[model samples]
Target chain A: MDSITPNEIDIVRASSSKINEIDFENLAFGNIFTDHMLMCDFRDGKWQKPTIKPYEPFLLDPSAKVFHYGQAIFEGMKAYKDESDDVWLFRPDENFRRFNASAKRMAMPEVPEDIFLGGLHEILKIEKEWVRKGKGNTLYIRPFMIAIGTGVIAAPSTQYRFMIILSPAKSYYSGEVKVIIAEHFSRAANGGIGAAKAAGNYSAQFYPTKLANDKGFQQIIWTDDATHTKLEEAGTMNVFFRINDTLFTAPTSERILDGVTRKSIISLAEREGIDIQVRSVLVAELVEAAKNGSLKEIFGAGTAAVVNPIVGFSYQDEYFELPKIENSVALKLKDKLTNIQYKLEEDTFGWTVKI
Target chain B: MDSITPNEIDIVRASSSKINEIDFENLAFGNIFTDHMLMCDFRDGKWQKPTIKPYEPFLLDPSAKVFHYGQAIFEGMKAYKDESDDVWLFRPDENFRRFNASAKRMAMPEVPEDIFLGGLHEILKIEKEWVRKGKGNTLYIRPFMIAIGTGVIAAPSTQYRFMIILSPAKSYYSGEVKVIIAEHFSRAANGGIGAAKAAGNYSAQFYPTKLANDKGFQQIIWTDDATHTKLEEAGTMNVFFRINDTLFTAPTSERILDGVTRKSIISLAEREGIDIQVRSVLVAELVEAAKNGSLKEIFGAGTAAVVNPIVGFSYQDEYFELPKIENSVALKLKDKLTNIQYKLEEDTFGWTVKI
Candidate 1:
């Protein structure tokens, strides 16, 4: 039934390189792209030949539905280069599955597993130089699908373009990371597109996050909409709380992204025999824990920042700071995750997918 | 800071004409486009001179954040041409206000009322012929804002572009609608981006709406996330249910859009001395009403399809059909609203904005 042989793809080297133009050190999270990108079109009811070409603009009509209706979905994962110059992906299969999950929510065509994995391999392999060799340095791969049909219908676009662009990056957030727990705003709702990494989810967050930034917090911890008591996620990153000797994180809900890192950390925590709870952590309970000296550390977990320690958080006009300790779980988890990513630690769980 | 003089505005009409290329009779919702478009850049922290230019492709860098992070917001409203050749907008001011509200949520810049109104006026005035004259026909104007700065920072974009594009003619949804009352799905969440017509909100909906479509329902009536028992809205339209001759519509919340037509319908119902309830209507209550013959009608209100009555609805595998009435509020309100829109009736509420 497969007309085109599996693993068949076209390759074209970039005529020129933007590698010289992008400053590796000053690179922001997702902005500066590498020399080449992977692109494929879904037409005639199937994905066409995947192609790797120079990262440049396409001749898309302005009336493309994606620009108008937001018929777009994207995935965020990184490719790390270890000491031996070998590149690795921390369970890109999970990202592929999550990407399809997002696509299903947005009514986009689900990319075949082979196509998604092939696209990623094709992109990272060609732009291997974009993978920076150092701690907190990696090639951020942005795999996105956009509705490019030249029409403005308030419906789903029939045609789509799936592309994977690589960017050399450092930590998304620099310096001390602080956040506010949102009780007044929601990123998404149950029975809504909250679980999908559709483009609008991040855009929906910019305002509230900006307000938090204005209040001296680097990010926001979105709480459940009904009562605003149960912590959902950091929206972009899954959140973990360290209370005394035990660690707790909110279980995945329809409203929170089932983050790749969030799940991995759960496995890692179990391997190390640390006490952990995957349940709703009420904000009131967390505040009480902070006041009772039971809160040891609170950090965000995600692909961008493996473990971002939260310095302080404001909730209901009350500010609370978690006590810092020399023996902190955030520091230890960060080391373990990074070591697995950089190939310094044993891949006990086989989480590392070598490209 | 009033700067733009209409006489000095740079105007360049689209050289290519796609209007003739389109089949008006067979037109599908937002798929076709007209010739000209309006654009004004936000640079140096101020809106630049607005330009009416040819509708064409945009020269965007590959790293434009809108493609990845979904940094965009938009407003949907229509311009109606009366039999006497007068073009009117139904409460365009409400659209402008809501647009900014969405802008605030997405962290896009607020478009000044004057600029937004002035731009639409200019565009509509120039493309007057494209504003179809037939009943139930109009020019759909899409006013949108997109983050333009090509930086990959996972933060708010520094630069933005406010644009107005025109799509000629036809209703979005065809025929009498059948809806499914949501029990497990939600449109927006409390303190979430539900109230805003942000682009992401729409993208997030495509997949869920598809599920409803597959279930043989044309659209869905989204319910509150807290319990998923109370009815909120249709996919794109505000919902209204009639029980024992009393009109009831859910109050706009942080999770519901303050629809322009919705407010108009409320006022029209009140002015006509019709009993109305602006409160939550539980889904079970409506389903029970359907069982007991207390439910009269279910209608959806929005810009595209003024007031669409749901012929039937299904919940928990039980289907209920709304009996066709001699003069349903859905039909009456639709006529009244369209009359005011087409300048056939008195603009008692002053919703008509003459172009």
Candidate 2:
């Protein structure tokens, strides 16, 4: 494990290709992968030289801290291809910054920007062919860190593994979604790991979200843990509400993720001179707005789906069906973000990086 | 990938033993593992054959769900050796029941009893020599489950791996522990994964616990998430207070783990005719009792350290030192539990299982 300087990266090319076996027409979101992956190790007080090798299973000691204690964090982003086969990344710097923030909260070492962004640059260059050219098709990039130390003393790990894997994906969800406002179960507490892209944050919602699914809901709109009166976020996504013409979303705090897509939409809305409010959104007010037909549209903002529209929402015994509008904020924001990502529109905000 | 029946266990003995290389005199808690481990995999909607294989590194896909989503749960127990060379387990059934309960909360498949307990029975038989005969020396058993599916999806993994590993451990802590009442950080919410032995629960404390450690405290006495008013659990342990001659502890709720050692201590205190109270313990009242000299003893109960005595506590810029007392409840309970565990006391409660 030689120490890696800022700009050096070791590469090992695969002997053969597995890309021909993949079916891009009916691709699952995170299933199929590219040929190569990127990896770096934090061992003996410094990050070792990063390497791009053929994507394969690696052997780990059974007592690795990651299997016993959840000291893991991940970042999700996507690369889109234009008609000319040019690759573009939508705001990879935000994901990079948030990845380190997640590491700091988990008591793990942060990867340097050179190692993170530089390694991604090298791997994406090699695997750019995996980025399919279409409206919703993409090469989903997952950069993650795990505690790979070989002891299990209920403490932070000394050794860490940071890796990037690429998987081709189609749109996450096909149609409009229905969600239930969480009343009993809480996704995260005030001083917990809700805001970070911590691994445990997603797993904690699976059970409660399963209950909502059983009751005919596709997702859950989680509320604040203290009183469950203020809406916070949806499962794996940040939520936004459009009341009449004003756009409202919960402010980012220790309790809510400062999502990349949510901020992008806020910026785009500001550019469009639309009324935007970032504050505590009360469930009572949202319900009242729904009753008075002021709640025009509801959608989720995330890296996976860009924007997912919600057709209806259920609260306790009453279900509110959101009125369909000719011009939806979700559709407008999704189209703008996608156009920038696919290189169809000018990158005025410099949100997309070309490779 | 063959299906294993209830009574069938495939065994693959280690080619060579690493036991000679290990130093029993200076063994860390979970560092030195035995020669063999038990494993069973859930694949394609059914659990495969259980196997007791030589302990080795496992090859996992880079996209394994456990690394990305933290779909993992674990249990801790111990095995003791008597003078006659008979090995004993203290309430293995309790750990088995709790493991499945944890699995349920994580939306994972419940491991069959035969796979869990039977695997433990076989592993103990093969590595009985790891159970050292001493007052504190014992074989610490770690049973854990992890999501092993080859995908980067945020949803729960369909494939699972259940494993048991053994490590020789002495007493966990060496001195009297010091803890601070948490004022800002909360561990779990009213409807979160606090009660489950989920992997994330331990890692979540590392950051905040490090804050207490910096302030010279060894652990933290967490309060309720709603207001941080009532006492909850101490760092990974159930807390107890001895006010005057009565014992008090927080009642088990969704926010607190139902610790096995806690219940055992309650039963042992009942048998000794000591007054025991299980209810909400307010932090204000606890502070007042300490100030007035009614708080004689504060201890933590768990599987790692049967009972860990606390010397003092800090709250809101004020540190209170507890006067040491003769006939301390922590010492009494520790002696009682270890005696029962090592076959030095009567087996009146039917707690130990001899193998």
Candidate 3:
């Protein structure tokens, strides 16, 4: 739990930049990366010195525990550049706390804040050029940790690697997203590692999501595994429902992630005086709301897409199309949140941190 | 789905074997590996050529999906050397089928039989010297697949790598194992990836197991997550209970693993005219039986420890010590199964296959 000073980090700059050969406007999400990345190793019950080096591949043994036992955790955040070319990180401390929580659940080492946050600050300063000066052009930050211990036994690893890799990204927009309510497959269990930002939780949804995709749906709204009645999560993000001008979202629990964007939206809605309910939304309740024409909108909130609006949803062989309306709460909240991130508006909540 | 002939495998033998340096008398389960290993890459919609080269570390991108999303699966099997120096495998086809099922569930590409089975056969032949002659000595085989696609996305990877690494080991023996019945933590959900040998499932049990270890117990007997009333699995293995004379085991469901050794034990017990019931064993029933002196035995069945007998278990904070009885079913079954595996007993079921 030792704190790492800024001087303790070793820096190795890339000789050349790939920025000139790239087109930032037309970029795929998480496809291209910044020139430099941060890495730190944990071994012998202690964290090693942090290093910011050129982004490249690293060596691992064939029997590394990460490859066999999946002891890994990750976080997703973004860095924004304002018109004055000042870089800002949106609620990075939240991600740092959640990352350690995930590490504890996965039985991995908890990264020191100085290494997690201070190393992030140092790396961002070195790669600030990758953050373009625009509201939509942000640098996606992926901080992940994996077990590097070389053994295949089903036990906690003694060695681990914490890394931060940056990718330039544009505003994410998935067209006309349609979702299906899950009846069988689930992303997590009761008293399981669902709330952690663990790697396994995401891949566990891929097969079910693929099945939904084959049926012309973009995502699945997962339900409680035991009864499959309570709606839990939308794809990998936290979901919200709008009924009769009121927003409803499930409270964070062991089965649902405490998403940063989700909490921000709840705070923004409360400040804006929008009627929002934090409770479990059952399937029957949603069906009844759709039938009575009270359901106005459905959206997912996460780091990748700050607010993703859903056009329709299928439930038990029945499809319900949400009515098109002006002044969507989802879009309004997204705009306000992004404005605060880009420093266009006053940071009333003090969520934005200048680099 | 193309078949790879023996000649299709490219072999690069190690210049010298490390067999001399390894003390065959004393070795850890997965710590020491043979000189050569098998590897094959999947890309551009098809698997490339398979290679058998010197065992060593390999490079991977920091953003590999396996590290970020846990898109990986693995199988554990062991190679046995009979008295005549002929190596044998026990029900490898079952492992092959299960491996692909795991691949399908994780949304990774299915490996062809040639690349999986054929590669193992080729590698075992080259490292045959590592397989010693004895019933307790074994060459543990680990076949695994991981997503090698470089992206920070949450979707399935288009690229993957399949490999086989052999580790020499003695018989696994954890002395006087005591277990705790799970009340909160769970290994799998009702509709989760518990049946597949997914890497994530193993790591999910580590934290809970560590908690049990701290209390002087070796492992946790996971119960149904929804109600925690039915016994599901023990550590990473399938659990069996004996009440009076009849043996009881929970049927394999979405929350339970369909273990190879577990099925073989069921078959062997039937052949020996031992009463065995495949149904859900309730926790309350087990406690009542323990109080009535009918709960005779509890054991775990898996590849690593073929038949791991539990000396005692704690349920609801009440410790229950099993009476030491002669003619223990667990040891009897373990001996019979090993005899058949080592070619000492008659191959009545035709389960063993020559490498």
Question: In order, what fnat does every candidate score?
Answer: 0.71, 0.73, 0.77
Q: Indicate whether candidate 1 or candidate 3 has the larger TM-score.
A: 3
Query: Which candidate should be chosen as best, given TM-score against the real structure?
Result: 3
The best candidate in terms of lDDT: 3
Q: Report the number of clashing residue pairs per model.
A: 9, 0, 0
Query: Can you write out model 2's per-residue Cα lDDT over A45-144, one digit (the tens) per residue?
Result: 8999999999999999999999999899999999999989998888989999999999998999999988888788788889988999988889999999
Q: Rank all candidate structures by their DockQ, best first, as comma-separated numbers.
A: 3, 2, 1
Q: True-contact fraction for model 2? A: 0.73
Q: Mind giving the per-residue lDDT tens digits that candidate 1 earns over A220-285?
A: 999888888888888779999988888899988788889888988888888888888998899988
- What C-alpha lDDT, on a 0 to 100 scale, does residue B221 get in candidate 2? 95
Worst 10 residues of 2 chain A by lDDT: A1-10
DockQ of 1: 0.67
- For residues B169-217, what per-residue lDDT tens digits would candidate 2 score against the true structure? 9877777689999888888977889989998888888889888889899
* Pairs that collide, model 2: none
TM-score of chain B of 3: 0.98
The candidate that achieves the highest DockQ relative to the unseen native structure: 3
Q: Any runs in candidate 1 off by more than 4 Å, and if so which?
A: A1-7, A20-22, B1-5, B16-23
